[model samples]
Target: MAHFDASRMLSFDLETTSADPMEARIVTSALVSIDGAQTDMLEMLADPGIEIPEEAARIHGITTEKARAEGQPHDEVLAETVRRIKKAWEEGFALVVYNAPFDLTVLRQLTGSFTVTGPVYDPYTVDNIKDRYRKGRRTLTDVSKHYGVTLDNAHEATSDAIAAARIAWKQVNKVYPDLKAMSTDELMEFQAVGYYDNQENRRKYFESRGRDGSSVNTSWPMQD
Candidate 1:
């Protein structure tokens, strides 16, 4: 197995206006590039052109007034965000995200023209696959805590993104050591296949429990 370099990865996360990716507008986002002992971080806040809901604001602490007054225009934010992400991909940095589907879906909705081409590393999905029976919660905070990584700010995009990268690094070194052998492209393929496999298993589990399984999405990155 080839040794993986954690510092070479790019970690991304988003804070949105709501829970539903399709309807929610991205309020803030962070992209962090880790290189050796150095780290570069970019953060963007978009006005979203809509009122930020009270509950959502309570969660992330970005109120509608704050967003409108301080955030950049939605289109401009989306364009720059897509540009940076694509640049990172072109530079061959493996993308690490925490619940990638939600963020990727929101990104697609906002950018419309951008497509997610991966070698993506989703720590959420990877953790589920590695420890299917570990109960309670699988949220970014929970996962970080499980991996003994400190997440100082829970809802903030930059903190969450960095924590996710750290958790993924730990998981690779501790749980799925064999994955170290795979190149980023190979890792991406593995994630795609594993996503479908896990979806199928979840569908079967729901069916066995006489629950509706149709809502379970088979797609990775986004549901179509």
Candidate 2:
């Protein structure tokens, strides 16, 4: 039962062309590593080989014109992103993702072989479980503000990745220190189970209201 080393972490985030991971095309991607005082980031932008929607461009500030001029080849960026994520997992670093399912599922769909065998630390899931009764929305922005983690550039991949890592690090070490003592596998199960239960409860609530609860798949850390 290896324990999660909160002192060291690797996080991934992506700014894309759409909201749905299934339909999104990567516009920017980041793999950030945080160890003690040192932080390193591998950030990349892709041309996406398609038009960037106005809404998405507004969110991430990656215009179609800008991406086409400066971004790398779509295939190259996608493959390299997956390669580095797998490599980081091989190096015993827990993957820190704000919303694990969105970015990871995008990578999974984009690179067919995008998969991991190591522990994953999803702050989004952790925050939802840890503060299940919190009133406001649990978006990255909301959680960042609630935790007092700075998110100056809300939609950028690198900034979002770093913010997520800091938020989780703080949560485990400061807010809910008991989580720091859980085994690596235990931590994974905690998020997995918590997310599943939360989603199931939400589904029941929606169903009770006579709404379609099936739209939101209850799969944790992945869409399907």
Candidate 3:
């Protein structure tokens, strides 16, 4: 395995008002910067400007009342979050998101533009690609446990983000060792190809299971 400095990574996650990225608004988000043994984290909560459904609130524990009372406005929070992510990218930190499409797509929709550029590492996609034969669910928590990373508070943004970073670290050592040798731009290109390939594979899997694979999105970063 190639050795890489962990400090040159940024891990991020978002808790949203709903499961559908196009419809949901970000309720909470976490951005973590890792460097060796040192780490910095920023956590933000935003008022989504709509009623948070009970089921969605139960998932992440952020109700509309709590958001309205304690959170920043959506626009301000989103702008600042995008600014931080862009800054991290420009500074050469590889962005590590647990599930890149959901969070990145949501961010793109909220900002009305593509704000996060990377060497973006989506542990979800990478894990799926690396372990296609593994059975059972591949949730972040599941993959983290499989990789021997502790993920406390599964649905919470900060905890999930940190866990994702740790999982990516472990995955690189265990599976995608070549990733360590790639430049940020090259890794971005690699993921762009891998994302679509995985999507096509997933579509075939669903179709083989007699499910509707047509709805599966082939787009990465954002579903077109």
Candidate 4:
């Protein structure tokens, strides 16, 4: 079991080179203080082991030339990112990813292709995507609109990560009324077992994509 602390949550997001998280390469990533006081940005040119599509480059501004010129080695950058996140998780921190399925799926995909040094904070994650739809909203943009949070530069990871923190802080308190009263451990337990049905759209997505058949990273918990 695990726990959550508002201050210990690391809201994160990644900007990748493609729409399919399983195949995309992370061009940039950002982690923001759960309290919204400070932030850190890690922008890198991922080798991607493939060509960087022009459309994707236009989205996050990471071109192949730029990556070859200044981006850290892909494996090194990934190892460090996992290391940092794992360090925080070991300290009782829970990561707040807007859509846990997308980012975590990307991470697992990358791990299958490359060597990742440590575990990511997936089990203790709060999925804002699932939460939003459960509340009858359509998208992150819709939830952001409802919460009055500024969503500047929607696709970039840095902006998205910060927005995720603000979103989590806003929604958790609103939907889970006793969030503050629960200890970090209790909060984690609550989120892990929380009950809410999926929207029809998501159910259809899983059906069409055939992605709901089985758990992918079932053994991640035992990884070092």
Candidate 5:
């Protein structure tokens, strides 16, 4: 986590429809810039192109009717989101997603649905959630509580994004003492091990997700 300079990073979070990326809907997104101390927020009520299950709305608070009224066309929003993400990457910033796998998976699905073509952003390229585990917390809420970071309107894109950045800062600074001394790759590896709750539980999660635990080899990762 400390291997990379915080100034070169961007923390991002997404509020989506479901846990399954292939079937998820990215309702809103946000990014926090570490370099300039600025935050960029992009939120929308996404037209899921299907019914919004009541269970899903309970989590994100975006209903199907609300989305249909205020949300941008699905294809247009997808392209813009992809373009902005790429633009940020080109500017020498790596995206820091909480659950990189989930967010990136949903991003990939959204792009495909829109028929947008190009390389999808690999979230592992900039995940800090793994690093936060050094403190013995796993879920975002626990990390937030441990670090005194308020979710700020919770479920909202910008607030969650900002919270992710704050959590990363607190966790990384604890390990390296100097945020400027670490390499990006080193930081990522540190985060991977740091965030693991326990070797056994971690392995179980991967096995359940159908992941080989090296790289994500299957979409389901594992079955419940």
Candidate 6:
């Protein structure tokens, strides 16, 4: 049997036209659900209806020309995605997001009806909570490396989703075994508190370096 804290976990990710989630337009999104050997992946490309800046396109490799040519309408993609995620959450799967705030905020902005339906877990947030003094960059690539999860495709939505799930699995089964015993809601709350404290700690760290960190979002799963 799979050793995930729950029998099922749903992980999703997105590549968008901007870094600020509130202003971003989705270019690609992926949902990956895993229950033991069975994995279901839904990947969508959306025509963002705006210019995809060169810097953003370079990150996820979804150029404006390609999106305009091959992607589906933004509404169609977001609607289907919302349905899929809601159904999964209703079925009792924990949601895994790498950096939950950014992706969730983007979804919230684009789909007005997309409120997160179930307890959400953020691998990045918990990692910060559990590994506070570890000195390294906390990007998905860096954390996946520390957790020994394979992240061969760095910025791709589908690959990132899978990696997030794997890292969470590692945490549950081995790295942070105590986390498995907590209820999803409890675990989520733990992350929320940890996220807040971590943000404050970061502000202190930055100020110590003669810089300001007050502009960063301290929200847990979503920015607004």
Best by lDDT: 2
In model 5, the worst 10-residue window by lDDT is: 116-125
RMSD, one per candidate, in order: 1.9, 1.1, 2.4, 5.4, 5.9, 2.5
Q: Which ten residues in a row are the worst by lDDT in model 3?
A: 1-10
**Error at 25, model 3, angstroms:** 0.5
lDDT of 5: 0.59
For model 1, which pairs clash? none
lDDT of 2 by residue, 1-224 (tens): 67888888998899999999998999999999877788889999999999999999999999999999999999999988877778878888888998898888898898776775888999889989998998989888989999999987899889899899889888998999989899989998899899999989999999999999998767867878
Residue-level lDDT of model 3, residues 181-204, one tens digit each, is 876566666667778888898899
Candidate 5 ranges beyond 4 A from true positions: 1-3, 112-137, 175-180, 190-201, 204-224
lDDT of 4 by residue, 1-224 (tens): 33345555776677777877757777776766443355555544456555778999987787888777777677776766666667666665567776565776677677664332222233223443234445554455665676777888777777777677676676556655456666655554444443112334445566689677333322221211
True-structure RMSD for candidate 3: 2.4
lDDT string for model 6 (1-224, tens) is: 21225448889898999999889988988999987689999999999899899999999998899999999998898888778789888877888899999998988988775787787878888888998999979889999989889997999999999999988888888888888778777887798889988888878889899998878678888885
| Residue 4 miss distance in model 5 (angstroms) | 2.3
The runs of at least 3 residues in candidate 2 whose Cα sits more than 4 Å from the true structure, single-residue gaps closed, are none
> Model 3 segments beyond 4 Å from truth?
1-5, 208-210
For residue 194, give model 1's deviation from the true position in Å: 2.0
Please list the C-alpha lDDT of all candidates, in the order they appear: 0.84, 0.89, 0.83, 0.59, 0.59, 0.86
Worst 10 residues of 4 by lDDT: 215-224
Best by TM-score: 2
- Number of colliding residue pairs in each model: 0, 0, 2, 3, 12, 0
The alpha-carbon lDDT assigned to residue 94 of candidate 5 equals: 63
Clashing pairs in 6: none
